[model samples]
Target: MTDLAKTDRPRTPVLDRVTLPSDLKGLSDRELRQLADELRAETISAVSVTGGHLGAGLGVVELTVALHAVFETPRDKIIWDVGHQCYPHKILTGRRDRIRTLRMGGGLAGFTKRAESPYDPFGAGHSSTSISAALGFAVARDLGGDPGDAIAVIGDGAMSAGMAFEAMNNAGHLGKRLFVILNDNEMSIAPPTGALSTYLTRLYTGGPFQELKAAAKGAVSLLPSPMQEGARRAKEMLKGMAVGGTLFEELGFSYIGPVDGHDLDQLLPLLRTVRARADGPVLIHAVTKKGKGYAPAENADDRGHARGRFDVLTGQQAKAKSNAPSYTSVFARALIDEAGRDDRILGITAAMPDGTGLKQFAERFPRRTFDVGIAEQHAVTFAAGLAAGGMKPFCALYSTFLQRGYDQIVHDVAVQGLPVRFAIDRAGLVGQDGPTHAGAYDIAFLSNLPGFVVMAAADEAELVHMVATAAAHDAGPIAFRFPRGEGTGVEMPERGEILPIGRGRMIAEGHSVAILSFGTRLSEAMAARESLSARGISPTIADARFARPLDRDLILKLAAGHDALITLEEGAVGGFGSHVAQLLADEGVFDRGLAFRSMVLPDRFIDHDAPYAMYDDSALNAAHIEAKVLEVLKIGQLDRRA
Candidate 1:
């Protein structure tokens, strides 16, 4: 190790020395801070290699270091809301050596996992879950008569969600022993909006607060004991009227500091004070910067909310040759094309205007586009309400985030049969983000809802057609899902046209085997088709557009004609393939001898890597698909030889 590396290395470093929380107790405060700095450097290097979450981890470095240093973790629960900020926590808790492989297949997860570390009391990927998880831990501790603490670290962005508010209300009403750290960075991915952000701003700025406190202390020190008692009562009354914590106070928690989260001098002493004093619920508002030490991320558009590998000095992204347009860009262009013609069209996103390709729409029709921050449930219902009010609303969201609004999909839109169009992006394995960010469950959840028309795009051209199909069909709820990255270099459609619902087209005609694919996996299925053809095993290929309201006639025809049916989808169990299996089972089509295999995401959560590598691990790649096809055919050949 170099001289700088030598000084940083623990003589039995807290980061490398301890795998479990119990091992954290012996370390001194000075050593803990050194460990924090080391953890930060390790995280930055690891994410550069693994290409995962960046800014969130950087912001939480000191907080993670301080929390572990003060508290007995695992025994005393600390629940991380959104879990994106857990990388530093992972580094200090015995996973430092494995950090470089973060988010890769069979490596450490990008988010907190209960199974991965005992220090992670509750697993989380979604935002705004910490308060509830911490509350649960609090109640469990009380019932078991365990002397332990429950701390929840939530960001300003997550505080916008309804669930966070609900948890706060319940925790306050119960008056349990819980500590809620509102990590106020004054932004989520973007600058936070609403009344709460304004209130937090007042609490932290210390403009009038510092002046009033000094004057009051001077007055109290000068008074006699009898006069001081009277002054104390008056001071309490004036402070109550002036301070903004009435909201948290009303909710029943003892609220404390809008402290400087970045300053270790302020943070360590304040944390120790809070640890010693107060019994009931407490809310500590700690203000910090998203990209504190890194200049590039600090000045970026979204505060480098999610970043790829970049130059450490200049902070420019590593360049790659563009072969084809990304799926997000394609979706954006297609939406722009549709919106240009239709005046009634409007776009809405749940805090992901950029991620879901709604930025161009926001630019074109500023009044028509809505960026409802981190509130997926509200975004869906809000879109449904817009549709009911005689406007075409396209609620663009990621496939994973849409799962947060599953109830809204069933209760508000599908049940009512509202005309809410869903432009679901990231429909498959998202490289580097790992399983937590994977768009694996939307197909399963949405397909099961009634009166829902679900379509998966095979390419950018098909995405255009699907978008047009959604716009034209104003009678009920409709959705089209596409994968994260770029599309296949298919020719772009000149004009948007609607495809017939409950119908699919054959890509190629063949005998013996029919390969049915849904969504982005169509490209891989085509490759498998070519490979199988070269071996004299010609196979049929079809893109099943609609997962729900399945193409009954097309699916049945393919199953009857082909000796074997191989169904493929870039989703989890009980998705497109499962739906096909259900239809085949219902019709008794499987009574006749036929080999069937449903190719879907594995039962385990997939890790982050390149999209192709992730697919390969889950057996969804072209090579694996070809190998599976050969294995099935070989079994049939053995019977024929017999």
Candidate 2:
């Protein structure tokens, strides 16, 4: 719509010749710099069309070129920590042709995927995993593997996670020769917050320590004596009067930088020197801006972290107007309303303030909102502590990310019977982000936890009541999951009411067949009911709000009253439907000759696509539900065939 595809394509003479990283080996430093510029242009151009991560790839353009030019990828391993910045890497490693297809169905993945390319030795969607993976590669090389060098390019925000430190400690203990390039962009998806962020800020800005440089040179005794003296002084001057890298040195790594990541002249030499001279582990701190070039991205909020198709010239995103409010907004407003009434209510999110919709809540109640930096485990336990201390804590997280804190859920909250309320966003097949971000397992995982109250909203209105229900429930851990997109245009309640804990309300009454729905799939069930009605089969429809507490009375009544019963949910197999089946089994409803079926997400991981398309592929859409009902009833289709 904005002519982004035309009049904005950058001329890339140097980049045109490069089909692979091997081609970069022959180029001069000046040519490589030219190529980086072209690559950056190409990255921007490609992302403008496809709309994936813009700022991260832009930030690491020079670093990506430098890493590939210096190291023989597919032989030497370079693992990107979060993979959001790997678009430039993908471009260099012969994925340029399909770069525009990122996150599309059957297209190149948004993250570094091992299955997509040989150069991607490891796959990653989550952050803070590169260090450990690189260490594994390093150890593998030591144990007679072919990998030449193991390099991990990780962002500063990723370093805040406990896993990175754990990996660093192990690599230090093992005394392996490893290279860790700390890409200090001063940001993640949200502006990073933690002591580590402050430490990194101080590391580059604080005065230089000549002793720190000398210690680094001393640690790598393999360097030639003449070069060692020159390198030590060079490092000292480059460090800029800062007593930095002491923390890394204590962990058994020779710290080398605080260098300009965007400058090819500085990056190429620093990297080449490290590749040639380092005897043991080396940590290079490379400072960079998150959105390095392209005025639009650099100037925008979020630093153009993720975007839709946009006007390349103006940086205006092409966002379609939503017909209804997003489920996230509904949850946020509901929580904010509840928090206003209760002073003890506190909100917590792992690293996502905007993604979890806590940004607005924080604006209203800044003191009560806690963003624990990409540490889900800490967030869960922290919320548990808040609940333990007579506070009402809502631990809101994307359903997939909450998997990281599963142990905390079981040990700290569920087992201890803490009153931490979990508001799970992105609770179904999220479009474009693929299976890595899907919220498929949360229902199954949380429903099984002892004394846990699990609910799923049928619509935005139901979400409000569920939030209130969660706020009032101080008996144990309660969680409610909602999908990623807009609600079904239902009228929103002015205020939420606290409903009975385990009761499901009937929507439509019929005799022959019944459809019991949970979560957002209630819409599909209603549609299926209409189709059945057209065929003179007016099937009953009910919304099962709670999943953990088997709505025994409602379920049994549906089972007894109907000739056939179908359970539906937007979750994996062992969730609402499975629980319903289990309850029916225990109550001997199956012995009464009631034909039953459960419709849920299939066993396989659904790939990235539009949400409706994904559901259709999973055979959980309205048409699929109608077909299943017809087949189960042995009606029109069976009669016709017979």
Alpha-carbon TM-score of each model against the true structure: 0.89, 0.95
Candidate 1 structure lDDT: 0.80
Candidate 1 lDDT by residue in tens digits, 437-520: 899998898899888999999999999999899989898999999998777888898987899987888999988888898988
- Worst ten in a row by lDDT for model 1: 206-215
- What's the CA RMSD of model 1 in angstroms? 4.9
RMSD of each: 4.9, 3.3
Model 2 residue 578 CA deviation (Å) reads: 1.1
Those runs of model 2 whose alpha carbons end farther than 4 Å from true positions after fitting are 1-6, 207-242, 636-642
lDDT of 2 at 320: 79
Q: Which stretches of candidate 1 lie over 4 Å from their true place?
A: 1-39, 145-147, 206-243, 586-588, 592-594, 631-642
- Quote model 2's TM-score: 0.95
